[model samples]
Target: MQNLILLLITAGSSSLCACTIQPQAEPVPSRHVSTIVIRQPRGEPGDFIICNDGRVLVFPVAHPKTCS
Candidate 1:
């Protein structure tokens, strides 16, 4: 019937419209982190340790410098 042909045509057109190309999402920017390396002291007096949060810990004459 004419109604059945029209229905088929409408369905085909709807499916074709549904197959459209969409714009892709934007890519996120990557972050670069910088790391600082701290060397261990020779257990000498006046030796210091710099923590990750910019805290300075100085060792005494008999103790070793360590970050908690």
Candidate 2:
């Protein structure tokens, strides 16, 4: 029927309009290493140190003020 053909055409048009294409991004090399130091409160979670080169160091909670 003509109504069935019109319904099919409308569905096809809506499906085509819903399609999208995203541009891909090129990866860039890192230049410098980054360092992060975290010192949580005593008896708390702890501390963590991370480097940009995928290095990680973890230590227990300690107070420098008490020792110095």
Candidate 3:
């Protein structure tokens, strides 16, 4: 019982003394991701298509006349 009380006191005292209160950091500025709006030409088949999500998509243009 004495050992338990002594252990508790030692732990409590050490934990209380080991603390360091540091200054709080400043709040970070709100970040705004601005998108650059560019006028993209319409893409033909086998050409690049500028998507609304800022991505380029290209698909093969199959000419049915050439597929004889």
TM-score of each: 0.30, 0.29, 0.31
lDDT (Cα, tens digit) per residue for candidate 3, span 1-68: 99999999999988777654545578998699789998755765464567667776656566322211
For candidate 2, write residues 10-58 as lDDT tens digits: 9998887766344557799999899999865666566666756666767
TM-score winner between candidates 2 and 3 = 3
lDDT of 1 by residue, 1-68 (tens): 99999999999999887767555578888698789999886755476779999999877857776677
- Candidate 1: the clashing residue pairs are none
Measured by lDDT, the strongest candidate is 1
User: Which residue pairs overlap in candidate 2's backbone?
Assistant: none
On lDDT, the stronger of 1 and 2 is 1
The list of candidate 1 runs beyond 4 A from truth reads: 21-68
| Error in Å for residue 12 of model 1 | 0.2
Q: Clash pairs of candidate 3?
A: none
Question: What lDDT score is found at residue 6 in candidate 3?
Answer: 100
